[model samples]
Target: MTGALQADLPIYDVRRPVLRLRPAKAWRHFQNLMKDKENTEEVFHIFESLPWRNLRPSAERFLRSARGQALRMREPNLPAILDDHAALRQMPAGSLAHAYCDFMEREGLTAQGLVEEFDRFAKHHVQFQDQFRWYLNRMRDVHDMLHVLTGYGRDALGESCVLAFTYSQQPSPAHLFIGYMAGLNIRRQVRSDAPVLKAVTEGKRLGKACPRLCEQSITELLPLPLEEVRRKLNITPAMHYREAHRTWAEMGVDPYDLLGKKLQKAA
Candidate 1:
């Protein structure tokens, strides 16, 4: 807690990371998540239930990467900078910071918002290697930023696409499962020909070719032009994603409210 002396205390002998999966728990959470998309806690629970992240193989791969090495050398307090809306607004008009701030303000969200959501899940209580814990938090924190960078919205489909993209960038089985499953679930509910799965597939393809944002310096990235940042990072246009939205719009449906209506009808 902030009330106590805060420090990144390292374990003298870090425990070797292990791999595990809890599909039943994740499925249970997913069921709850489906009833109400706003249940962000269930999302985290799903992630925790499939806790392969930062585990043995993944940990080894990360430690080998330049970004991971850099993070251990200096685990920056990224959320602090990201949460500073006033300072973000002070950035150049076209900078990523400005865009991020604008998105958060318009959506009535904050960096701390996701943080709080993650902490609500039981996994947050689990002890992790201090550095690895930061890596996880950094992954969690940049999620909304990914939405901004990828042009994905907070809609149900958009969330799946972002997670698909995230799976590509981070190679998390949990992310892959949630992303694809969520997309498929949407497809099952809707009667339209929106190529929902294809849009999510495109997200994975785009993610593969883009730079890993978690490894980048937040302060360095924030000042760069938004479009320029995308270009520099090799983030491509999400054509299929836009196409899905267009399809939904032409069909006289609000994709954001699509699932809710479908659920109500079923009820």
Candidate 2:
């Protein structure tokens, strides 16, 4: 099989990357966050302050526990995820994105001009300088495929729930947990209702029930040209795209804006 095609394949690893953090570096990050605690607290506080809230304490506890599992796990799925992304980048221009756009168009999820957005960004942005941009793009690109796999929607709540699941299963501290927390905050802001909150809680709980099951779900539902067992889920590309767009838009702001800049500075 060609390397490009192999990008969609599942990867199982028993180890995670270790960061040898200098105390000073860690302290800087902590202080920066502390300085902006109000903004961060506001988002999370939304969850705590909501009425008709059905985010069970059990579910919340489960998500926290899952986060702990991710932290303690030896190896996360970063290598595999990055490998898949590199493979996608190698495909012909009209290949993967076209497939995604076609799927979205057929589902009435996005307008015809959608591909242009990606094209525009790809043309103007040298992703190498901004690894975070590359990360964001990879996240956006595969996001719909993930939805097709997991049967989640594009809403703030649904996406956050799936992210929490992804973080639990994959255990990537840099991307997974940060994204999960952001999604949780955004979901709380947008939909504080009982059903929405319940879905979020249930998604996390189900994620905790079987991390391997969740990972397999991601592998199976990816919209790649693979012969893996396909299970029909309730999610659609449009829904996933919509939710991803919302979440990333929020991430485009100040502190998070520095994500790409940080990588550039380090480089």
Candidate 3:
């Protein structure tokens, strides 16, 4: 918020050919993704439906920042760096890089997989300047890394909370909408006392207070202990999220698969 987006704080201040919001299309994509959670392309389509003001302005500012200049100078491929498990494994124990590597290995995920998922949508084919693309790719590449930093798992609630947190950092309406909808659905469907909305809202608050992780280099943060990294990033423990999880457990609701099962039945 301080750098790329701060040039104009107002929503209307935008470049030519403003990306208009298509609520109906975004809703359809959301429905398709909710019904079949594996359809990751729908997620990208949702973002496209409610596109950002041309990032040209953001790109202009990004190019002026130190991190932006460093990225441009080296032209490091973020996904490639994340995929290099060998190199990441060499990071010190308890480091963010090591935890991230472990999480990726356990989840059988790769940064490249997210890129491939977005590519399958085919709607992101619009031409963008290299700096704009770099800025865009940087956001996409940090999705899983966010999970690690925020202490959020890949479960349904975790994903929702992370999105809420992301909205606070990036101020993306789509992210907030999805997080709100997801939290609503979970609370309505799950027979539990879990404070779903409270947890998600807390995520947003935490994110608003935390520093912009996108402004920092992944490699630079990788070598530090996770706690140190979190401290530097101003991320606090997710008290509400942990409390909600405990309540869900007490009520015998499986947070991981609860939404899928309920949604499939509703459909």
| lDDT of every predicted structure (CA atoms) | 0.79, 0.38, 0.79
Q: What are the clash counts of all predictions, listed in order?
A: 0, 5, 0
Pairs with backbone N, CA or C atoms under 3 Å apart (clashes), candidate 1:
none
* Candidate 3 colliding pairs: none
By TM-score, the candidates rank as 3, 1, 2
Tens digits of per-residue lDDT for model 1, 1-267: 221112444422157345468899888889898787888998877876787554544645675577666655554566777888888888899899988988998999988887877776645365544555666677788999999999999888899999989887787677878888888888888888898999999999989988777777777788999998899889999999899999999987888877566768889
Model 2, 125-183: lDDT tens digits are: 33232112222223333445444445555444455556555544444342233344545
- Extract clashing residue pairs from model 2: 15-75, 16-74, 16-75, 149-221, 151-235
Q: Write down the TM-score of every candidate.
A: 0.86, 0.33, 0.87
Best candidate according to TM-score: 3
Model 3: per-residue Cα lDDT over 148-245, one tens digit each: 99999988789999999988777768888789888888887886778889999999998998866676777889999999999998899999899998
Off by over 4 Å in 1: 1-8, 11-19, 53-75, 259-267
